[model samples]
Target: MRNIFIFIIFISMLFVSLSACQKEDEKLKGLVIESSSVEFGSLQNPEDRELHFRVQINDYGMESEQEYKVRFIIQDAHISDLIATEKIEVPETYKTQLLRNDEARTIVTGGSKEIKKDFTIDEIRKIIEKDEAVIIELYDKNRTIDREVVTTFAENIKPLVKVNPNAKLEHIKLKETNEIDIFSRAISDSNKEQGISYIAYPEYTFSLAEESYFLWVTENNGRIMNTKDTYTIYSLSDSSLKEVKEVIDKK
Candidate 1:
């Protein structure tokens, strides 16, 4: 009788251990890193720049009853100095809510939920610009971790500048004129084909400030199209185009 009781107790303990392992395995069943790489275009200043990313975790075993936290670490000394050291957390309620949403369904395929957050890319650029090495580590709530490395190169670091083509046309006026000429050129070599080559000459009211008008010319088939360049000239003084204080064309 004593031997049988001892044997039963040992079996019970073994079963419990196996069950615990199974539960943990289930928690991480569909957990995966969707966009591990965080890209920050170019950092001209030391001000902090952040890049957002998503971590996809699938709960195949059971509904998420607890929230999960994620932490970030920069192992390299040079890289660490340039970036802010911080860890981000995702609440359980937030995860649960997303899991129940339709959009979350798209991120969590085969029974999973995706949690997205942003990280500092500016910090990484600062370190790299100085010819330093960067190591990025992402830690999950369950202690699972992932990392990536970025090396400093001449091609990888630069300044961020964009040409806003949607800028408003200044000094517009309506006049009866034939054959209005619109001049446009490609800013980049690759954009030579994709660049705007068409102009639109409206017969109605047609007058705009020289600064307000942006000539976007494009070539179609074998002929040049000018109608594409003609658009309702927006006012630079308006709130929509006010943020666009200026438009700079490379060519």
Candidate 2:
């Protein structure tokens, strides 16, 4: 009888352990590092030379009873040195909330963060020149969820400079125009209110002057956001009409 009882207890414990492992696996499957990018600070300011990078994370799992935390580590891949670290927490109630009434289903979710580090212009240039300039790793505790090795910073790094108010603002106007276009066509009819953002690079004129920038139109519908130069838009369904129009006019 005693032997049978002991076996039963062991079997129950093993079942619980297996269940927990499976739950964790499911949660991880819903999580991802959606996108990452590097932004350079003002080049003319000797005291304010810096590098700012953003990492966007998303969790597509069901609402959790407990809070969870994830981390991102950036390193100089060539030298094996740590550059920066960022942490994001998903609160206990953090999950996509859907509103289903008379209109379309509006899903609301948010998760994004930015890290800034000071580096000299020369140091920054040299660091990015390496074949593998930067290595970004995402961790859920000790387990690595994702790893991205950036070979060249040419496409990722967008240099910033002081704006001359008096100069013609053609590029800024163009970016605003693009945002309005997205707002009118894609966002106006849907359940989402449009919000557009971008990182503008210093315009270069070798052959002919052209507008250069990274634009993102978000309609908050999911947990993940993209922060790269690409034109991938997120469906985040919350924003004010006045705010977007103001941005267009001010630009």
| Residue runs of model 2 more than 4 Å from their true location after superposition | 1-31, 42-47, 61-74, 77-130, 150-251
Estimated TM-score for each candidate: 0.28, 0.29
Put down candidate 1 lDDT per residue, 94-136, tens digits, no spaces.
Answer: 2333344422322221111111232233444565544434333
In the predicted model 2, the residue pairs found to clash are 219-235, 219-236, 219-237, 220-235, 220-236, 220-237, 221-235, 221-236
Best by lDDT: 2
Per residue, candidate 2 scores C-alpha lDDT tens digits across 163-228 of 343654334343445554644433333332133334343231111123232223333322112222
For candidate 1, the per-residue lDDT at 9 reads 100
